[model samples]
Target: MESSSALALSQLPYYIYPTIPNTNKNYPFWPAGKRRSSQLPTRLHCNKMFVPGFGEASPEAKAAKNLHNFFTYIAVKIVAAQLESYNPEAYEELMEFVGRHPLNDGDKFCATMFRESSRHKNLALRIMEVRSSYCQNDFEWDNLKSLAFKMVTESNTRLMRDYISETSRAETEK
Candidate 1:
């Protein structure tokens, strides 16, 4: 009879397990399946990217890489800010992308500085001010500025493409 009962239990589609009491006396008031706030997954505070040759590169090479990252980060910020006024949804998506993407120390520093300066009423003036402060020389500043412009153009293009595709899809649905 015991063997038959055991076989019957095994054949059941689902079995309910007995709930065990929480063993930790420290959190006696806490509910089951709940965790402390400190145990939760924390969001990254900054966007830091990993450059392949950064660690082993010469000082000059490292500086060049940092400059490139800084301009790229600034470009992304500029594009994101532009989108915020015209298309909030696209702006949100861009911000999410920025949040997810990895950046290096240089990029993080640029982002932090930009964030601070962006509080000013005139974004263009602040950007120029930041450029002046960071860029080593006029030629270097011009080159980096061009790179930032190129990045903004490319990002805008991609956003436009996505917007067009979405419109087309809506049209098709209609």
Candidate 2:
């Protein structure tokens, strides 16, 4: 009875994932068309791709790669900016890009600098730091000015949060 059952199970159509199909370069592996052919390897070739611990490259891997490249770009720009002479045009461009991205810390600091016109040293240092870390562009002079501006600008949320908290507390007390 066990043997019969085993045989029956074996006879049943089971799902199979073809490791590689033998067809031309363009076809769908197993010869879907005469004009088109595709190649599928039965086994993964290490020379072709090496996947270690994980089964496959995850989305996280892709993201990490992108982030790494972005940071590298920033670092190169920073070093170049610092070593080279001051250029107003480069600072402007950096500011425009930052304005578009509008990072909270970056934006706030930039705004402050623009208003106070202080912390030029801080701004320069940060510009180098940001570039060293993750900046990836041929920064413009205006953007550097903007970065300085953000350093000095007031945070809008600071006052708003305080007001809301004070009003709520008063209402509760009443």
Candidate 3:
């Protein structure tokens, strides 16, 4: 695996460009036996891997880890709520069936019919409720608020605005 700089060193057709290595020629400046350059290119790729936006060394890795934790927390909350609110035998049977099959696993779990519905806030809160096991005295919805903000800002802000205008126009026609 040659570095781009190393490959570049091979491309000098004329007297090597001063920026790249060109020891192929028998330059008299070298000792009678020296074959290659003594220096190596410094490796610092800046386009793709960047410092984290919030002062993190590995921004992308941290975001990925946080998202993983958040998703796992939500999944556990969903399962626990389903178990607490339903019959364990039914949930177990459903897990067993899905365990034996290729599937989406969460939405298609069947026994969690209501939890899989369209009420995003309710679903998230219920998951929080299950995970926190608290009643009425603060369920930590704020923990997910930042994630929700990011999802809205990054994923759907423009689409949602356009959809709202489209829906308004369609409603006016009706």
The order of the candidates by TM-score, greatest first, is: 1, 3, 2
Per-residue lDDT of model 2, residues 111-163, tens digit only: 54455444444554565467444544454547867975775565566777889
Q: Which one wins on lDDT?
A: 1
TM-score of 1: 0.30
Off by over 4 Å in 2: 1-60, 63-66, 76-80, 102-174
Which ten-residue region of model 3 has the weakest summed lDDT? 102-111
| lDDT comparison, 2 vs 3, better candidate | 3
The true-versus-predicted C-alpha distance at residue 125 of model 3, in Å, is 21
Q: What is the lDDT of residue 72 in candidate 2?
A: 40
lDDT of 3 at 61: 69
Task: State the C-alpha lDDT per candidate.
Answer: 0.57, 0.50, 0.51
Ranking by lDDT: 1, 3, 2
